[model samples]
Target chain A: MTTPPPHRPVPQPTQRVVVTSPRTRAPRARRPYSGTREINEQSELGAVYMRTLIRAQRRLGLSVCLVTTGVLALLPLLFSLEPALGRFRVFGLGLPWFLLCVATFPMLLLAGWFYVRQAERSEREFAELVERP
Target chain B: MTSGYAVVAVLVVVLGTILVGAYGLRVSRTTSDFYVASRTVSPWWNASAIGGEYLSAASFVGIAGLIFAYGPDMLWFPVGYTAGYLVLLTMVAAPLRRSGAYTLPDFAEARFRSRAVRGVASVLALAIGWLYLLPQLEGAGLTLNTVTGAPDWVGALIVMVVVTVNVMSGGMRSITFVQAFQYWLKLTAITVPIVFLVVVWQVHGAESLTAPEYPAFRQDTEVTFNNDTMIHAERSLAIRGTGEVDGVRVDGGFVLTDGYHRIGQGSEFTFPKDATVPHLSTMAHNTNESWALPESSGADFPLYGAYSLIIATFLGTMGLPHVIVRFYTNPNGTAARRTTLILLGLLSVFYLMPPVYGALGRLYTPELLMTGQTDAVVLVLPARVVDGIGGELLGALVAGGAFAAFLSTSSGLVVSLAGVLSQDVLRLGGVRGFRISAVLAGVVPLAMTFVSTGMPVADMVGLAFAVAASSLCPLLMLGIWSSRTTTVGAIAGMLAGGVPALTAGLVTMFTDTGDAWYEVLLSRPAAWTVPLGFTVMYVVSLLTQRHVPPGVQRTMVKLHAPENLGLDGSGPGSGDERS
Candidate 1:
């Protein structure tokens, strides 16, 4: 059993090594380290992340809004196209009255509920991705 | 109706609001609390407060009045008002909360990084606040005049004083509790009467509710004109009346021939039970037989007016200074979003009751149509239907609710307006500055109400929405989403959009040009002005790309990033990222 000389360079397995300046070190691979601050400090990464989040959020918002808007916009047209529908009554109330006055609100609430759920989910996913270890 | 009960009810509401304000004052010790309730309001409380403030005199009484007078087409007002939150929930709520800006002007300065843009935004906010406040004051005057026989100015003055004092004393912190309590108070005031009214309708056979033709007086009715009124007659009819008819001094019975007939002030007219109600010239389209018909009343281009109203209300809520400022009270972006979701529910439940009052008013208070005082239907219907002490109590409840609507909304507006005025215009940032701003914010609108007469409360509110939709809506939508939007583009867009809208609103307010095109375009400017605003913003931003704010990327990151991601997302400039 012989001890190796302290000055003698030990032969180690060849490993991949890329030269990098200490001033611009590779990003840390940890959950808290790679959160929004790191992403923000890295301007290019922040821009990409922000753009993607915005695009996703915008798409979700527009789709929900489109459906709601279409329904609202079509209401008058529907009544005009079929005047009888406006005259149609349910439970002693005029159809138009029932729809616009009573039914419209619940529909709005449902749409709002859907939007909140989807938006929160999107944010959650984005957070998870950014905070991945 | 007994005036005593109504007077008592109004006094109670005024006192309640003051008490709530004082309670809030006890807790609000810092400038932050004064502006954003120290950014600690929970979602439920904030949502309730928003509901209290957002349901103004327009929602409390005007929608029902419009529906009773104009029929089904007016239902769009409530629908548009409530659905506006959906737009806010999806696009602006979370990001706006994340911006950490207390007022619309704060947001403008932060996003554009330009004091010039902030100045423009502050001016627009003040204008919109004043425009919105005008209707609440007028509606208060109208409600008081109807209930207690007080001159219109008394009610306006009462509301103005109460709201100004509340804001001046405690600011947003105190108003938050006052508004939240008012929301529930308004709901109860509106809902309880509605239930009884519905039962009354059912007992009365609901026959008038389903009237296919023009509404008729169910019994011999005598209507006294408090003010001179011009009514449109569909066909010739003879009426027993006194005072000037169509400018002729009639001592006895007179025949009101076809076309327009003017009824002099203090004139009394008796109509037979089955005679068709003469439509007020102000409510032109309502003369048609079918109640279910979707015709626009008094609007030159009916379709355009309707669509413009829808667009204005749907987009305008996000831009409202008071409503937007409430979002900043939420603890975080998620809470803001949650608050919006809750607001939709609370507002929907509250809105469902107004139309019932309208339908019932058409049955019991048809005389309102002739007097051009349809707005009085809510205050008058309970007594008209229910008799004795019960009726008086119900009427008082409604009066209280009406006052609550006026107080909560005006207080919120004054607070937001004062915040912007002090922060941006006066460059003062203390309780004293806020008080001074409060007086300025409230008094101008109060003065305007005196000069402006006969404008429907709902219609006046619609004008404010048009201005907001044209100006601030474009700013918020572009500022949050488009990183390329420059300060020059923002200022240019706001001025180009807001000035024209404001001019149109003022013209519509002061003049009644019965011409179709002018009425349609000027009365509902949002359809054009909003698009113009967005286009100008986009084009100008493209042309002035070099002037895009330097911190835009960082701001975008702050706005879009999740709060739990451990980033400094709640500020204007992003902090350094050092691990």
Candidate 2:
């Protein structure tokens, strides 16, 4: 995010007074011992490193959530449009029953397993990048 | 079923929960803290604890009841409930724990740095917890009413007193192991009976569930209608009864016509073996063929109903007050994530048992449809299908398990709600604050059950999820992922989404406007309200961009970064290089 130059505070006549400038801009990127020091003190460079980690993790979470929920959401419409599909037997049980009751659990577990693996991997990669000598 | 065994079972479950809470209370945190937040209990044990706390009255009895009354379409309930944890695992599990706030309100205040947002979050937390607790109390009443032929309020009072005493006494101090013990107790109570019941079903020739014939009583049966009920008979039938039908007293034989008939309160009917059963008017009159198939939920918009239920449940689990507290038992972010995944497996195995009871209830307990006590299917089915003393023992086992579900879930809800209530509302700090809040929490919902119209227990639980999905879900999702959310936007988004959903849920519960076109919309508002909350929060935050929290960067670091990194905006940086 681009930090704005400081501005004078002005009280609004209609509402409560609001601050014009951010007090949270990490005291101008002080020179520090390491990246850890930079982050601990909240420098611009430290914000960059933190943003990278957040972006990677968010993308992983969004993709997994969307794909799994998106695919499952189509089941009700499928059963409605093609009535015969719901009736088709799978292993001697109705397909809708088989899919919704039996098959969905393992699929959810598999998706969760995939998410954990990827999330930890990215966290590891970020640590290695930050902790370099 | 004999009342003796069932009565004994209920007493044992009550005593068992009390004993377990007392046992947990006696052990101080240092020794018992092994499995609590201090890295003593491993992730799997924590998962079981969550499972214990979560496999509430809804999963145990309500799912099976709804499925029995409707059809296979109700399978979505179990599916959605499990998938909620999956969503929690993928999205909120790690980051939430890393945020270092034990409750949802804490997350709001920490993120927004505004008391206004925290106040709004606290209100919603209390509202959602109370709404969720309402059904657990109702389910307890229903179970007791069925088992001992006691009044509906007696069982509810027992649960309220027992749980209130437990929490007030601080017996749930080390709740992790106690909750885990509850999970195993509920699992066994539900599982062992299924094996025996299924074996009995197979021995009875595994009769086809999808057969075209209407369900017929296997032997001569006598039915008593304790409350006034309108029933629908598919064909003309002769019935023997003593009570009012069509406002005419028939002390002897009467012919039930091919259409609707009102069986007056306290009426008893005796039917010959192989007589066709007439189901209650509230039920969708379905033959075996239609009921076993999907999309036969008998509602006008079955598709919309299913989708709404899915949306509410899949996103709502993270917003629950009690569920959020369990995350703290884990030592760090990764442990929390692992705990959630193990919970998914635990929940999946428990969920599988409910639908089994539902399917079998359609066969052995078709009379439940006639009596409009379909929610009792789980408790009554064991005795109906299996014969002799074995059935009595198994029925007693199911009764005890149902009590376990009610006690575990409601107590968890009360304790967490009391936590929020004391800190936010009562402003009390010590044990005395918690005690007052706990009593108030139990008292408000128990009073509610006395006046409630008593809808099916599962559907009541779903409305609680709807409220969470509409209000708190947005706050958690937006507050975590988007740093630009401002104080004004947080308040506006919660009210905009929460009011409409909460109002709709309340409207559905207290009043019934028969077959209104908007009935589905009113009953299941999550399909629209969830997106409404998310959009309002995002758009408002964008408009009020200048009002973003000052310390958002530090807050983000605290939430998203691993704890071991020491980037928590504290003084770890100064000593880090030397160490």
Question: Best-fitting candidate, measured by lDDT?
Answer: 1
Query: Tens-digit lDDT track for model 1 on B1-579?
Result: 446898899999998888888888888765556666766678899999999999999999999999888778899899999999999898899888787677898888778878899899999999999999999999999888887777889989999998898888877888888889889999999999888887877787766565456667878887778898888876677788788887889877887787888889888878778777887887764533476566635456667778898989999988898998898888778888899999999999999888888877877887788888888899999977887888889999999999999999999999999988877788765667778989988899989987885778999999999999999999999998888899889988998899999999998998776775567799889999999999998899999999999778768876877665655443322433323
Cα TM-score of candidate 2: 0.93
Worst 10 residues of 2 chain A by lDDT: A1-10
- Model 1 stretches with alpha carbons more than 4 Å out: A1-31, A35-37, B233-242, B250-259, B270-272, B285-289, B296-298, B569-579
DockQ for every prediction shown: 0.18, 0.22
Q: Please report the interface RMSD of model 1 to 1 decimal.
A: 16.6
Instruction: Give the per-residue lDDT of model 2 (tens digit) for B1-579.
Output: 336899999999898778777776666332112112343467888899889989888889999999988988889899999999988888889888887666788788878988889898999999889888888988998889888888889999999999988776643445666678889988999999999999989999998887888887787778878788988988788888788897899999988888898889989888767777889887787888888788887898999999999999999888899998788667678888889989988988888888889888877887888889889999998888888889989889989988988888888888888878877888875556767889998999999888778789889899999999999988888888888888888888998888898999889988985699999998899999998988898899899988898788888888887666556755445425423
Q: Candidate 1, overall lDDT?
A: 0.83
Best by TM-score: 2
Cα lDDT of candidate 2 equals 0.82
